[model samples]
Target chain A: MQPYNYPSKYLENAVEEFAKLPGIGRRTALRLVLHLLNKPKEEVEQFSATLNEMVQNIHFCSICHNISDNDICSICSSTSRDKTTICVVETIKDVMSIENTMQYKGLYHVLGGVINPMEGVGPADLNIESLVNRLKSNDINEVIMALSATTEGDTTNFYIYKKIKDYNIVVTTLARGVAFGNELEYTDEITLGRALLNRVKFNNSFSVE
Target chain B: MQPYNYPSKYLENAVEEFAKLPGIGRRTALRLVLHLLNKPKEEVEQFSATLNEMVQNIHFCSICHNISDNDICSICSSTSRDKTTICVVETIKDVMSIENTMQYKGLYHVLGGVINPMEGVGPADLNIESLVNRLKSNDINEVIMALSATTEGDTTNFYIYKKIKDYNIVVTTLARGVAFGNELEYTDEITLGRALLNRVKFNNSFSVE
Candidate 1:
């Protein structure tokens, strides 16, 4: 595509800034900027104000390091949540992904990132120390490593496991198997093998046998 | 999809604002907000500031109705451009698309939008009067209707043609034809028929004979 030559410097600058976002290209950025331009003046101002306010006022949970309005997150302060189990994750996004499942009622401990030597992210760089302090101070009965299925995730999980191995608690990881609704034909060999290795007993609940 | 429940209200508000943009869903909005959260405070501040500044300060070209930094646009003010010819388009985005083509060296007239009765848009609502005033005051030789191929585009084209029929200037439109690089098998009947009816003289540039 030809180099963009927007009519206004402000439009060009705005497009440039929006283009810096992940997965957004110049064309899409221009489209978005034009959409903003068409919006009412107050609405655009409100949009801008919302972002600034969020960035300035947002807080990280003091206990779990998740994004929060207050020092402690809602889940951490809620008495109804399972206080004995803490799910150790790579980032705040993982916590949200798990929460969306509506399955787990336990608390979360965001590591901020995984241990990746290539990226120069070490165990010390993450919120691992804060997690250790939480474990030491609390009567937590279970610690679940809910990181991704990547090498960095595995390394981070192992390091955290070592740090909390002395504790009189059950340490577990997410079950590795064929995902629900996933066809075996499309499953990779390693995942298929793992699914077979950790196969669960067949319980035909739908059958009237 | 599960209902989103971000840890922070600020995060939720920011995501909501971003989700209002075209094609951005709640999930994508959340991802973008989280990405913003990860950026440096100064960078995010700059992003917010840039948007506000653009919305507050951006100008529209008085001559062509395109988005402009100053009173007149570059194309309209440039000395080398063909001032005798004007390509009328539907929006500022259309002007940018023509500019990107690097084809037509003529000036432009942005209608802001085409006539769409179904959407309550009419000639009176657009910059048609301004265009007529420009024609009456200036010595323009030709006017090209470069609007879309939709029914609204055709209606606006005929309306404009009728408005300028009494004027001494020649009026034209973008030729309706089968587009270049389109496969014959997939070409729609009307377009293919139009292409056949308006077939150009054969040129032998590629043949050895």
Candidate 2:
């Protein structure tokens, strides 16, 4: 079937706007617009107002390059976090993911994106300079690379490794292995090999006690 | 992993609002909010303004209950459409789907929803009365039920059938069978039985010259 041409220009415009969002198709956009039409005027107003306020006021953390309402993000400014150990990640989402784990209490350095030659993203395009500057000025002891398990992530890690190797800071990568609760038979060979090679002590694997 | 608590109230509020939409998770909502943050101020303004304008000003067609910018929708007002044949659908989305097919040139009667007892929706809750009124006022000869293939749809069709049976109107339901490109072996029993029982003339099935 061909696409339905909406009769009302207002409905069409609303659907078009909704469709601009990531992963939202025209059919889904129409459903969302119609749902808004059924809601109270005040609620619709609140939804739009909240989005507008976010877009207009939201800023990035000056220190970590993470999303924030001010110059410095809460994580960056927090006194409890281990500022000497900075976990370098690709995007703000990565920062949120690591924060969710509650396993990493260190500060973050968002690179915005990984170095992908195909996408024209290079070390120069990332926040590498700021990271180097942070290393040069601050008393950082460790730099943990918590990037994705991909070629781009590896490339970015290597690039950053070469840059900070001369600064006398310990550089490390996230441990590669089968995820918790994953079946050993279903796990890929590379991950299984790595997990075996860098096997942690059984007592150190759990904090339940 | 626990969720990362957003620093900005505005950002959190926006993400929460986006998450309110059907099928959108908190992660997807955050992505959408971040995408808006990256967009230019004017584009975001336009997105909100369009939704606001639609919710504030959009109206439904008085005759058919279809979404419209005015009292009468284009389909309802169109002189070329066969007003005598009214296609009864559950929602505006159905109308759009039928229109997209470009096979039916008849008018439409939007019932808004089926008689879903589980959800507390009944005949009184839908726009059924208006449809009956339209039949009474107009020279409508046929009323085609274009509802979803569900028990609720069947219940609604039966209910409406009882209401207008004595009015000398020809009431019909959509054909049920295996869909195009579907393998006969995989077709369900009820649909396959219906297809076999209501087999059409061989000559009428093909449009190939």
Candidate 3:
């Protein structure tokens, strides 16, 4: 397809910048940039300034490698969280997902990325060393591997498990089973099999009696 | 759903700004903002700066009201373009679409937007006055209404038609029919009917033998 030539060089530049965003194509970029043009001057300024300030000021948590406004993240600083348990995740996004669940009260250690050999990412490339150091230094009891189900996530989890195996802490992976509201028939074979093997006794008290 | 509380305030701000975009949801915005965090500092600077510079420097063409880096757009300044004809479009996107076809040699008059009463947009909101002024001053013979097929587009077309009916200029709209590759069975009723009503004579000379 012939690239839609923007009437203005400025519009073209804006569209190009927008297209750099993940999942945004050139046409969608154009549409977005045009929408910005229709917005008030202050609104557009705020939009650009927000990004600029974020890029300039944002820093990774010194302890867990999660993004933070300060050197130490809010979760790391909070005394109420389960300091003994550290949920290891691939990125800050996973940390947010777990936090939103409101089920896990433990602290987090963001790996920044999983070990993907195809992408030239290895154990050394991640924040694994700091995690190992945290386990050695802190009075931690458990380390939960909350990575994705992909090969890269598995590889990263295995690498971390090997590194921290010598420590006195218990290392565990997130359970592989049929998710809540998911039908057993549609569940993947491995997940369904795991769910069946680890089946819990039906509790009458927990049911709507 | 509870908004994913980003660890960093800066990250939150960036995500908020991204979510302000036309079709972007909060989750997608977070993904994009997080992607920017992974990019190099200089690359992020370029992305923001590109938008900032574009917003600050962009202007509208004095004659046609199309977006321009300069006072006069490239099409308006070009000696080769047919000045006698002007294609009236609802937005700069339409102008780009037509220009990409490379079939029309006419200049364009971007309306910025069509009349939509429900959206509180009317003739006063558009660049209709300047278009009428152009018809009066310039030796333009024909005006092509390249607006969309929506009710708003039709409203805008009729409104403009009434405005320029007495100006001794030929006014026309884009052809309505089934698209070139579309099957007749799948074609919408109005388009198929219009195509039939405006049927052209078959010419063997123009066809492949």
Which one wins on lDDT? 1
Regarding lDDT, does 2 or 3 come out ahead? 2
Candidate 2 reaches a DockQ of 0.70
* lDDT tens per residue, model 1, B1-209: 87877888899899999999999999888888889999998898899899999988988889999998778888889999999999999999888888887878999999989999999998899999999999999999999999999899999999999889899999998878877689999999989998889877677322324
Please report the candidate that would top DockQ against the real structure: 3
RMSD of each: 3.0, 2.2, 2.3
Could you tell me the lDDT of residue B25 within candidate 3? 92
Give the lDDT of residue B9 in candidate 1. Answer: 86
Q: What share of the true interface contacts does each candidate keep?
A: 0.86, 0.74, 0.87
Writing each residue's lDDT as its tens digit, candidate 1 over A31-148 gives 9999999988899899989999998999999899999999889999999999999999888889988998888999999998899999999988999999989999999999999999
Q: List the residue pairs that clash in candidate 2.
A: none
Q: Distance (Å) between predicted and true CA of A155, model 1?
A: 1.8
Return the lDDT, model 1, position A19: 94
Q: Would you give me the overall lDDT of model 3?
A: 0.89
User: Docking category for candidate 2?
Assistant: medium
Candidate 2 chain B lDDT trough over 10 residues, lowest sum = B200-209
lDDT of 3 by residue, B1-209 (tens): 78887788898888888888889999999999889999998888888788888888988899988889999999999999999999999888888999998789999999988998899997999999999999999999999999999989999999999999999999999878778789999998998999889876679324534
lDDT of 2 at B131: 89
Q: List the residue pairs that clash in candidate 1.
A: none
Candidate 1 residue spans exceeding 4 A from truth: A203-209, B203-209
TM-score of 2: 0.93
DockQ of 1: 0.80
